[model samples]
Target chain A: MQVNFWDRNQLRLTPVFFLAPAMLLFTVYVVYPIFSSLWISLYEWNGVGEMFWVGLGNYIEMWEDDRVHTAIWNNLIWLIFFLLAPLISLGLSIFLNQNLTELRFIKSIFFFPFVVSPVVVGLVFSQFYNPEYGLLDFFLKSLGFQPIAVLSNEEIVTFGIILAALWPQVAYCLILYMTGLAGLNREIVEAGRIDGAKGWKMFWNVILPQLRPATFIAVVVSVLGALRSFDLVAIMTRGGPWGSSTVLAYEMVEQAIFNYRMGYGAALATILFFLLDIYIAWFLFRVWLNEKGRL
Target chain B: MKLFISIIVTVSVVITTAMAGTLKITQNSSNANTQKLWKEQIIPLFEKENPGIKVEMTIYDHEAYKTAIRNFLQAEPPDVVNWFSGNRMKFFVDQGLFEDVSDVWAKNGLDSQLSAARSTMTVKGKQWGVPLTYYQWGVYYRTDIFKKYGLGEPRSIADLMYICRTLKKNGVTPFTIGTKYLWTAAGWFDFLNLRVNGYDFHMSLMDGNISYEDNRLDKVFDIWGDLARKGYFIENHASLSWQEGQAPMINGDAAMYLMGNFVVPNLKEGGLSGKIGYFQFPVIDGNVRTWEEAPTDSVHIPTKAKNKADARKFLAFLAKPKVQSMVAEVEGMLPTNNQSAAPTDKFLKIGFKVLSESAGLAQFYDRDTNPEMAKEGMKGFQEFMVKPDREKQIRKRIEKVRKRIFKK
Candidate 1:
C-alpha cells in the first residue's frame, strides 16, 4: 500500500479533530472550574464584590473552625457506612438471581427506592423519624419503649440521615450487581461445580472473581456518592440540631450561599476536590496495574 | 390581515410611548396575602396616581431573595428593592450597591415620620432606604390556657418561672420553639440577652465587639439553660420548623411561643385567633431598661437603577402615611411611619404599643449581626437549647466564628 504524507497526517489529526470539542467542553465545565475554585479560595470575596487577596487566610480559618471539624467527621462516618450498600446489595442480588417467576416482582420491590427522588426519600424519612406523630414513634410507644427523636439527637442524627441515603444507594448497587450476575460465565461455574466447589466456596471462588468490574464500579460510585451527600442532609436535617449532621458538601453550600462567605466556601470546595482527586488517581492506578498484569 | 397587524404594532408602540418611566421593584415576601395586596391594590393605586410612570413589582420567597438580590443588584439592578434594616441593609450600603436615598427622605420629611427606623437605615450619617413595616417579638400565649392556669401575664422572670412551673405541673410544655432553621432560637437569645445584660451589651455582641464567651453573657446563658434543662421547651424542638412549632401551641400541648407579630396570621389560620394574646418578655433585672426586637422591612433604590428619579418617587410614595396604613392593614404588621394610622389588627395594636413604649429597638439577632456570625451564633443557640450542658463548647465555637468574621 502506498501512503502519502497527507494520509499519515490525516490519520493522526482525525482523532485529535474528533476529540477537540469534547476536550473543550471538559476544559470549560470541569477543568476550568477546578482552577477557578482554587484561585477564588485565596481571595476574600463576597459573591458580588471586589476580591481581596487573603492567601491562606480562609484555609487557616477553616482549619480552626469547629463546624468544619464536625463536617469532616461526618464525611468520614458517611464513607465508612456507605460501604455497606455494595456488600448488602451483593447478597440481595445473589439471592434474587433465581428463575422463580415471583422473584421478579420481589426484585422490583427491592428496586423501588432507587426510582424515588432523593428529596422525597428525605421527606419520607423525616416524617418517619418525627417524634410526636411518626410511625417509628407510634411503634415504639406501642411496644412499651421510649420514643427516640432520631433526627433531633446530635449524637445519632448523622446515622439517621445515612440510613435514609442507604435505602436508594443499596438499590442502585443491587441493580449493578444483578446486571453483572446476568453476564457471568456459566461454563466457569460448571467447571468449579465439577471440581467439587459448591455453595459458599463455589460463589466465593468462582462467582465473586467474575464480578470484579461490577464491584470496582460499585465501590467507586458509592465512595463518590458518600462524599457528595448534600441532598438528604439539606432536606431532612439541614445539618441542624447544631450542625451535627453536616458534611463537607453541605457546609460548602451553606457557607457560600446562606452565609455569603464565598471565599471560605471556595476553600472548602478545593479541599473536597483534592480529596476526590486523590481517590480517583488511586483508582486509575489500580486499574492500570490490573490491565498490565492481564497483558 | 396586514392592516390589522399594522394597527396592533402601532397600538403597542403608542402604549409603550405613553409611559415615560418604568419603575421595577423586587420584593422579598413569602406571604400570599401581602403579595396579593401588592399586585391587586398597591401597584394599581401607585400607577393610577402616577399615570406617566408604570410600576412593575416582582415578589420572591424569603430565602431566594437573599441570593437573588446580590446578583441582580450587581447585574440588572431594579428601580427599587425591598430589604431588611440594620446590619443586613448595611451589608449592601457599605458596598455602595444601594443608592443613597437621603434626598427622598428629606423631601418627604421621612426623618421624623420614619424616625423609629432612621438609626438602622443610616450609615455614615446618610439615609440609605425608606422603612416599610416592622413587627415586634414577644411571647404569644394562649389566653385561655393562661386563664385556666390562673396565670396573668408574667411580670418578672420569677413570675414567668412560676407560670412555667404551673404549666409544667399541669403537663403542658411552657414554651414551643423550633430550631430547625435556627433563627427561632436566636429570638429567645435576643430577648434573654436584652433582659439580662441590657441592650448595649446585646448590641455590642451583635457588632462582634463582645465575645460570645464574655462573662456578661454568662447570666443570659444561665437563664436560657435553666429554661432548657427544666423541660420548659417542647421536646424534639430541633426537628421542627417555626411553623411546625405552632402545632403544639395550637393543640394546647404547649402554652407560649416567643415569636414576632408575623405569627399572628398563622395562629389565626391554626384556629387560635381570638384566644391568642401577646405580652412583652418579662423583666429579668430591674436595672436594665426595656429593649424590644422590632425588625423593620424597608425599600431602597439600587445604586445602578436606570430610573433613579422614579425610584425615589416610588420610595416617597411608600413613605406616605396612607400607603403605610394600607401596608400595616394588609400585612398585619406595624407601620414604620409615625404619622400612619394605628394598625387595625388587635395583635399589631399591642405590638405597636409595646414598641412605642420601649426605650430602644433592636432588630432581631440574625438581622443585627454579620451574616456569617449570625449563622454560627444561631446554630450555637440551637445547640444550647438541645444540650444545655454543652453551653461552654457552643459559646467557644461561636466566638471562634466571630473572631474570624470580624477579624477581632
Candidate 2:
C-alpha cells in the first residue's frame, strides 16, 4: 500500500519539524551548558590546563567563606528591594496612561533608562554616587548634610547599586505595564463604574483581574533580573569595600575569571542556580494551581 | 551519510592554517605612545628586516585583554601577547599557557642584559617572557604645594607626619589614592609593610609563609592605621578609581601621591608637571630603604601560538637596549634592561636611580602574590584605610583565604 505524501497527520507533524531546530539549539546552548556546569562544579579546574577531581571541596570552602555569606545576604537585599520596581512601575504606568499634555514625550522620558545599556547606567550612577562633585553628594551638601560615600560604604554599597539598577528595571516594568494597560478591556471598567467602583475599588474589582497576566510576567522577569544582577555591581563597586556588595552571579564571575577558580565559581553558580530554581518552582506551582482550578 | 559527516568533522578539526606570512601581536594597551612605538617603530622595523613576514596587531584594554587572554590562548592563540612580569606571568607559566622563551633569552644574551628583571619573569627556574619597561613606585608630590607649605619629602615617619599635619592644617589631603579597584590600597600596604617590617618579612607574609594575624603584621597595620587616623589619606578614596584619585593633586588639594613611574606621562598630559617632584616613599623603623616597588610589563608567546618563531624574534628585539629605550622613552618609564639609556624625563631619572640602587626589588603586591591572595589583600587594605579599627577582622578574613589558597 502506498502512503499518502501530504496527509492531515503528516501536516500536523510539520509544526514539530519546524520546532526541531529551536529545540536542538535550546538543548545545546541552554540545557547542556547548565548540566556541564554542574559536572564541572565537581572538579578543580582553572579555565586552562588540567582538571583535577575535587568533589565537594569547592562547596565546603564556599560554605565557610565570609564573602559567600555576604553574597547571599546581598542577593536577599536585591530581591527584597527589587520588588519595589514593579510596584513603582505599575503606579507610573497608571499615572502616565492618561490624557495629559505631552504624555508621549513624558512616557518616553520615563522609558529612557530601559533603552540605555546597563554599563552606561552603572557609569552614570557612579558619577552620582561620587564622593566629591557627584550629584548625590552635591544634593546632600546643598541640603547642609555631610556627603555620604554610598559606593565606598560596605554597609550601603549594595543598596546604592540596587537603587541604580532599579532605575532601568523600573523602566522595563513600566513599559510592560504600559503595554498591559493599553490592552485593557473597557466594558468591565464601565460595569465597575456603574457599580460606583473607582480608584482602588475599580482597580481591585475590574482592572487588576485583567492585569494578572502582566503582573505575573512582570514579577517573573523582575525576580530573574534581580538574581542575575552582575553588570551594575561589577561596573560600580566591583563588590568592593571588602567584597560586601557581591551577589552570587558577580562572585561567580570574579572567582572564575579574576581568581582563576573555575571549579569554585561553577559550584557557586550551581548554588545560585538552585536558589533561583526554588523561586521558579514556587512560581510554576502557583501557575499550575491556578490552571488546575480553572480546569 | 553519518560516517561521512563524522569523517568530515574530524578532518576539519585536524586542519590548521599554515603558520607563516603574518605574526599576530596582541597589545594590552590603547595608549597612543605604546601603540605608536609598536605600530610605527617596532612593526615597520621588524617587517623591513624579516621581509618575508608581516605583522597583524590587535589592541585590547588592560582588563578585557586579561579575561580574553585565557580563552584565546587555548583556542587560536596570538603570536605575542602583552602581560605583566612576576606572579601575573607566572600564573600563565604555571599552567603552561605561555611558551618557554628562555631560548630567546639565551640566544640573544638577554640573560645578562635583562638581569635585573629576570627574577620577576622567571617561574620555577624557567624564564617564560621578555620585558622592556618596568617602573619604580614612589611618592609623586606637588612641589609648589610642598614648597608653599615649607615642607620637603619625608625622610622618616616623623617627618612624614609633620608634612601630613601641615597639609591637614592647610585643608589639603596629605596623599591622594583611589582605592576603587583596590590595587592602590596595595601600594600603601606594600610601603607601610616594607617600612615597618622590612622586605623579607613582607615577602614571606605575601608568599603565605607567615600567618597574617602574626604579631609582626600588627606593627605594619598599627603604623598604617596611625596614618589613616591622622587623616593623611584622601577622604572617600574608596569611591575613586586610581585615575580619578589624581584629581586632588591636579587641583592642588592634595600634596602627594604614592604611585608608579607610569604616571609621569599622565602628569605631563594633564599639564600638572610644572609643580611635580618625585621622591622615595618616606622610611620607617630606621631601616634602610632597600626594597623598591618595581612592576615589569612583559611580552609573552602563548603556548598554542601559531607563530612561535616570529614571537621569539619579537621577544629578542624587545630585549635590545635600542628597542627597550624607544618604547620606555615614549611611556616615560624605565626600561628593564640595565644598559638602556634613561629617559629625558626627570621623574623617570629619579625612578631609575631609586630602582637601580635599591638592594632588592618587589614586583608590587598584586604582581608578587598569588592573584587570589592579592585580590583579598588589596580589599583588606582598602578596608584598613577606611576603618583602621577593623584591621584585625580584615587580617583574619585574608588569613582564611591565604590558608585556603596555600593549603597551609
Candidate 3:
C-alpha cells in the first residue's frame, strides 16, 4: 500500500517539468497575444485612451474600406508571384548541382542576395528604380524608349517591389533546395539509373519524393513571406502613390502606429492570423496524411 | 519574503533619489545640430541658471517620437515635451494628456510677444503650450530662371498662370514637387485652400466641419488639377521624395517649388543659396485674405509630470527672446517670439516679413487636421496630383474618411 511518491508521479511530472518553460513562453508571447488581439478587435481603442465596445464593427468597416480591398488584392498578387521563388530556385539548384570546378563560386554568387538585409535590398532597389538617375531609366533611355517610373505607377508598383523581394527570396529557396539535392539518396538514384530512368524521369520519380520535406519547408516559407510582406513595401512605396501597394501586415502597422486606430489594426492582425492559420492547418493535415501512409 | 521586501525598498529608494531635484525633458528631434545644441548649450544654460535643478533631456527620432509620445505620456511622461502647435497639440489637449500652461503664457506676457503663433497654441481659449519657433511655407523659386524668363514674383492667380505658361514655353517645368511621401502634396492643398477659401474656411475644413466634396474644395482642386494637368509640375514627381524633387530646380529643369522655409537650408547646402527666392503663394481670389502656412514647434508640460514647477520654468525660459533667437539660429528657423532678433538669413527674412503681413497662420495641412484624416487626405491629394481626372473620386474617398473620423 505504501508507494514511492517520486515513482508514482514521475511519468506525468517529468514531461510537464521539461515542457514548462516552452509552454509558458508560448502562452505568454504567442497564444496570449493572438486572443488579446481578437479581444481588442471588438472595441474602438485609439491605443491610449478608452476602449469602447463595438463588436465586429472593425471587421464590418473593413468590408467598406477601399484601402483594405487594395491591400487584400496586393496580398493575392504577392502570394501568386511568390510561389515562383521555389520553382525558380529548384531549377537554379539543379543547374548548380554539377561537377564543374567553378560551381562553388557561382553557387555563392547565387546565394549572395539572401545574405543582404531586406531593408538594404529595398533601398538598393529604390535607387535602381529611380526615374531620373536610376539604372532602369538609363536602360530604357538607351533602348530608345520613354522611361517608366515603376514605383510611381500604381499598376506596377507592387510588381516592382515583388521583384526586389524575390531577389532575396529566390536565394533563400535556392539554399534550401541545394541542401536537399546534396542530401539525396545515392543508392536510389543508381537503382533508378539501372532501370533506365534518366534526366527528368530519374529526378521526378526518385529524387523528388526524397526531397519532400525540403520542398514543403521552402513553399511554406515562401507563402509566409508573401503573406507577411511589410518592410519592402514600407521602404520602397509606403503603400503609396496612395495605398496601392499595401499588404495586410503593412496596413495593420500603418493603422496602429500612424493612424492611431489600434482596434482596426488589431482586426487586420486577426484576419492575417486566420489566413495563416488555415494554411498551417492544411500543411499539418498533409504531413499527418504522409506519416500515416509511411506507417 | 525578506528578499522581496528588501528589493521593493531598494527600488523605491532609487526611484525617489532619481526623482528629487531632476527635471526630465523629452524632445522629438533627429537633427544632430539640435541634439548638440540641447546637450552642450540649452541644458547647460538651464541647469546653470537654476543651481538646484538638473535638466535631463531625451531626443527621439521625429517619426518614432510621434508614436512613442503616446505611450510614454500615459506610462512615464517627462516633465516637458516638444510638439507641433494646432490640431496635433489639440489632440493631446482634448485627451487631457498635456497640462494647460496659460499661467506661463500670462506671467511671461507671451500674448503679444508670440502673437503670430498664439492662436494655434490656444485650444478652447486656453494656451496649452509655449511657442518656440516656426518656419514659413511659400513658393521657393529659382531666381535666375525667373529673371531669364522675365518673370517677376506672381501677385495673383493670373500672374501665376502667366509665369507657368512662360516657363513651360521655355521648356522648363513650372514647379517641382515630390508627392511620394504624400505630405508634399498636402502643402499644395494647404496653400490652395488657404488662398482660395481663406483661413477660417480652411480651419473649418481641417476640423472636419466642411465636407471634402464641398463647393469650396472644388475650386481648390480645380486650381490644383489645372496645374497638374498642364504638366506644370516636374515629370514623375510621384516617384520622388521632397529631397529628390529639389534636384529638378537645382539643375534648372524646374523653375520653382512651393515648399517650407526648411528647403532654404537644403538649397544652400545644394549650393544654390542666392539663386533661390521666396514668394507668397499667388492670390487665387481677390476678396479673400492671404493666409500663410507656418508650422510652429513648441514645448508643453505633461499632465502627469513629476516636476511641473520646473517644467513651467523651462517653458518660460524657452520663450525668452534671447533663448528663442539663439535656438532659432541653431535650428535655422524663425523665432516665434516677435521680440526676438530678426532672422539674418535672406529667405528667413523674407518669410518673416510675409508671415508678419498675413491675415492668419495655418499649421500646414497635415498638422492642422485629424491624424487619420490627414493620412487619407494627403493620399487623396497625392492621387489627384498624379491623376487630375480622378479628383472627384479622390475627394469622395477622403470625404468618406472625414465622415467616419468626425462622425458626420
C-alpha lDDT of all candidate models, in order: 0.92, 0.87, 0.92
True contacts kept of each: 0.85, 0.90, 0.90
Question: Where is model 1 more than 4 Å wrong at Cα?
Answer: A1-20, B1-20
Model 2, B223-245: lDDT tens digits are: 88998998999899999988998
lDDT per residue (tens digit) for residues A5-103 in model 2: 667479789999999999999999999989999989999888887999999988998888888999999998999899899899999999999987889
Segments of candidate 2 deviating more than 4 angstroms: A1-9, B1-21
Model 3 Cα displacement at B111 (Å)? 1.4
Ranking by lDDT: 3, 1, 2
lDDT by residue for model 3 (B1-408), tens:
999999999999988767867999986888888889989988899888988788988878898898889989898899999999999999999989999999999999999998999999999999999988999899999999999979999899999999999999999999999889999999999889888889889899999999999987888888889999999998889899999999999888998999988888888788897898888999989999999999999999999998898899999999999999988998889999999999888878988999999998999888999998999999988888989998889889988999999998
Every model: iRMSD:
0.8, 1.0, 0.6
Compute DockQ for each candidate against the true complex.
Answer: 0.73, 0.75, 0.86
Worst 10 residues of 1 chain B by lDDT: B12-21
What clash count goes with each model?
Answer: 0, 0, 0
Better of 2 and 3 by DockQ: 3
- In the range B348-387, model 1's lDDT, one tens digit per residue, is 8888899999988999988999988898899889989988
Each candidate structure's TM-score, on Cα atoms with residue i matched to residue i, is 0.94, 0.93, 0.96
